[model samples]
Target: MVTEASETNRDAGSVGDVAARIERLPISKWHIKVRIVLGMATFFDAFDALSLAYVLPVLIPLWTFTPAEIGLLISSGFAGQLVGALFFGWLAERFGRRPAVIACILVFSIMSLACAFAWNYSSLFVMRIVQGVGLGGEVPIAMTLINEICATKGRGRFVVLFELVFPIGLVAAALFGWWIVPTMGWQAMFVIGALPGLVCLVLHRFIPESPRWLANKGRRAQAVAALDAIEREVAGAGQTLPEISPMKVGADRHASFKDMFGPIYLRRTLVVWLLWFGTYLCNYSLTAWMPSIYRSIFHLPLEVSLRYSLITSIFGVIGGLACALTVDVFGRRKLFSFALLWSAVALLSLWWTGATSAETVLIGVTVSYLGITVLSNGLYLYTPELYPTRVRALAVSSATGWLRLASIIGPTAVGYIVAAGELKNVFLVFALVAALAGLVVMLFGTETKSRLLEDVSP
Candidate 1:
């Protein structure tokens, strides 16, 4: 009895130590604040990305754009995203994260407002492409920032929570579009999309530059100052703090993008690149066509279909949070592989539902959406772990840029598929691709759990 009590006390002490360490991580508060801001930014992202989808139901009738022309407008932003990811990733390396992120916000905000003024399909398409650049730039840089600020143990939680903002944005879009598009018009949606960028501009001014980024850039004094401020913030709350050794990260000498593809990173690069392509393809396919798919199959009113979409978005957030809590415990490879396998099964069930009861269809779609949300959150966590500080943003952005290229193709291909009256068969393709993606990940991807951020690699 005495020995057992002693062991229990020791365990309690260890737990206390861990809690204190987590509390002392430089960016704990910053992470929370940034996620709140990211929620708003992601809301705009979803709003702008899907604004056309909402508008399409209204605009197709207004403008008489053929399926092909409508497809072009839908995909134009994705094309811009493809270019923007690469361009901004490169620029982030040169200009630092704070400037790059703010710049992207401004570019997208101004261009989205311009979209509301477009008189014709051609002008709207051009504006969308420009807006995509800003969209692409925002996420990759944000990911880079989050990865740098968060400690390794808290990484999965931080990344997953931040990622959840994206789907919430989509839900807000659906809600806004459902309410406003019918009352005011589709143009009002774009006007609404411009609001968050202004909010971002103001919020960003108060949030200091990332200490980790400063360290990675060899700005030791600034990094130390940032750390001191963080320590003061914690101390002000009357918390005991852990001692954090000051360490410089990244290269003193400038490194090129080619470094990402070198021998040390070759295997990691390949896995992350493929993972981005597969997961993005899955996410875009479902989100882009959700309203249309509901419309065609359920024959419901636009508002009712949108309500179901909003419900799914809610479930998506829940699913993301669940992943955030459990992913670090389970390991990225294991959780993601399971998410993929189940997503494939869910997609197959969705295909099966096309011939079954309405209730079954709803269940299937819900499962698939939930699974994909969990899987994508896993990728967001995994992608940043694969690269070192020197090339982290560039590596993540490179994969995302290519992934955006796939996103462009996924939605447009769906448009073509729908136009051909073969919408029912498309779920099968999604299932197969998801299955293959899982297999690839399971076979080739390295496990990353309980490892330091610097230790995660090919």
Candidate 2:
């Protein structure tokens, strides 16, 4: 009994020590190395996730697809992502971040390959849903791992820089669609999507399991070992680490789905849910439908439609990069609210103009894309900061599961709205949603800038 009690106290002490050590460590080459490897994996993830949008334009003409069928095909991956996010999130919480991330990478990569061989719309749709599972699971786990490893002072910039690859991936996909899809066919896009599987080997070789997660799980020895490895690298780089402030250690407990809805986390849970849903609803409604709209409504050639869509995606990448640069400077709440408000105004403008000319529509879509991209990508940095380490992956995953939900509904709604010849109403609805999202964040969201994760959420 005496030995057990002493061991427990030591473990508790180690938990607090872990966070302090991580926060005090100077940003080093090791940190950049980790981000680079992880960012590569995420880049491919973005490539695969949005590759379907580009493919849909090709598939529609080849298969003679109806708008509703097109919506279903677009939504299939999101449906899979919803399941993947929740399942992998639980896996990360119960198992570890490393294995969960690797497995998700493998699953998505293989499924992306399978997408290439799909003979019909049904087969392609099924493959997309399965691919989405891996794609959906990767983000929350990746973000959670990055969040735990980063210091509070530069956390926003670090994570956002890491996330910037996602838009880069989208831009790459758009360029591929503009060039490759027209030349080599849509199967080539899936071939590119499957390439990320190679990243799993690199991740397995370099990335360590999050030390904070190990400490929270009471595996103090391993946590110390991981931290020591990172510290040695920082030391080897000739940067002296700052002294770690002693923190009060609490009893370590296992986190559960129930914990997400507990009183302390409930408001954050709801706010992030609204944020994810509203942002994705607005985002995918425009992006997923743009190339299709250009093709069918404007009667543009496939290459020209893709080129226009690519321009909008480039604007999105620009917006995401801008947010990454400014998030640490201006803070999360203010930027998030402003982005949504901007999106709302842009969407309202599009609705008022009635998409009369291709030029008018492109300008409106570009502005809205810019605003929505900031909010959508910035959520990656913001959401994980709102939860404690124990439930951090789960909360982020669950919240993003709402994004998947929006991904599903938004496209399907666009299908019907476009079918009814009321496409302007789509903008009006998304505008209201964006306006509401801005208000919710302004009213209820907490600021996490420069605050330690433990202090912010605990």
Candidate 3:
């Protein structure tokens, strides 16, 4: 839907007329409103994703959960997320992003209610798996949709700021869990998470479909209709629409999972998979298990454990904010390489000096969280940019399959490692993974700083 500054691209292949229209539109209040609608979906997705972690402390004692069982329960959601990512990616390409996202929200919110009503461990475990499917699918599809609408010049900060809500959701969960879980019950958190579903009704009314997606599907009239909607919004906000530039293009709507492994995209696909796996492995493991570590290993009060975990999440929000401000200037490639190494160093410090005290462990975890979470925020922006509109949702959602995998592995690994009284090894291993991913990215990653979507991928 955006620009390509490359003179070669200008001559090689046109970005098509619909994409040109999207590229020329100026930023306006309309953009902000659309972001809020989409951002709210991801906000609740984050809350529902982490809801299990906050509830685990209470459930551990309530149900007499072993560490192995704790890991299984945590990993179960991610296991479902993996499936959701692939299926929804296809659904987005086949049906449309709007319907796919709406369906995902419904699936998770309704299942979250079922989770609240779960009477036993087995029932909740199954419910989380179903919920995970929705959780995994919403984000990649949403990111692709946002990228489709965004102009290239400021797209990095625009999308990253929108994605920033994800971390905010984590913060809200931790803070609310600290308060709500102790007073009311853990089930209230799931009930609170279901609130995003209410917004789904009003969503299609506010935001238009991705015109780039429409045109790519060879539905020229629908693409023009969506662009007409966006223009009306911009006009209502007291702005004159600029004239669109010349564009001549051909459709490449046959994009599928196969193209991602072809010569053009294979390296990027591999590097992005590593980034997703390593980043989420480190991130989810720490967030999901830190409260349990504080409660069980350090003998902290339940409230205190949740509060410390909340602080760590706030640090992660700070990391994401820093990314939003600077990713445009410094570029995605350099930032990713540095942040991954930074995460490796922070976590490795804990292993090097002996992770003895709860306070020390919290400090190390917070520092590691700061560096690693930048990838969590920026990858949403970076991943979509790596592919064109034809395959953007498919590639991004499939990449998130790696995130779900890491999420599954990380928590399960923590449960067993902690169970074996070798907690420091957790940091040691995650650090190595981070370092390895950083190296792969530094060597192989392409710089997609301000280029238009068509130029980069096509």
In terms of lDDT, which candidate is strongest? 3
lDDT of 2: 0.88
List candidate 2 segments past 4 Å from native: 1-13
Residue 436, model 2: lDDT of 99
Q: What is the C-alpha RMSD of each candidate to the true structure, in Å?
A: 7.0, 3.3, 3.6
Cα lDDT of candidate 1 equals: 0.71
lDDT of 2 by residue, 1-83 (tens): 21222244454326678877787876789989999888888999888988888888888979899999998899999999999
Model-by-model lDDT, in order?
Answer: 0.71, 0.88, 0.89
Model 3 Cα lDDT, one tens digit per residue, 211-310:
8887777776677667776877787888877767666455555767787998889999999999999999999999999999999999899999999999
Instruction: Give the residue spans of candidate 3 off by over 4 A.
Output: 1-15, 248-253
Better of 1 and 3 by TM-score: 3
| Tens digit of per-residue lDDT, candidate 1, span 1-458 | 21222133332212122222333465445557766775566667767877777776777667887656766677788999998889898887777777777877877888889999999888998999999999888877877777666776677777877887777777778788788888898889898888767766665664566664565566655655555555566566655555533332323445468778888788878877877777778777667667666665557677766666667767777778778888988888877778888888988877776635335555666687777788766676777778766677788789888679778888777778768876656677888878887888888887877666655531
Question: Of 1 and 2, which scores higher on TM-score?
Answer: 2
Candidate 3: Cα lDDT at 210: 82
Sorted on TM-score, best first, the list reads: 2, 3, 1
What is the lDDT, from 0 to 100, of the residue 179 in candidate 1? 86
Return the TM-score for each candidate structure: 0.88, 0.96, 0.96
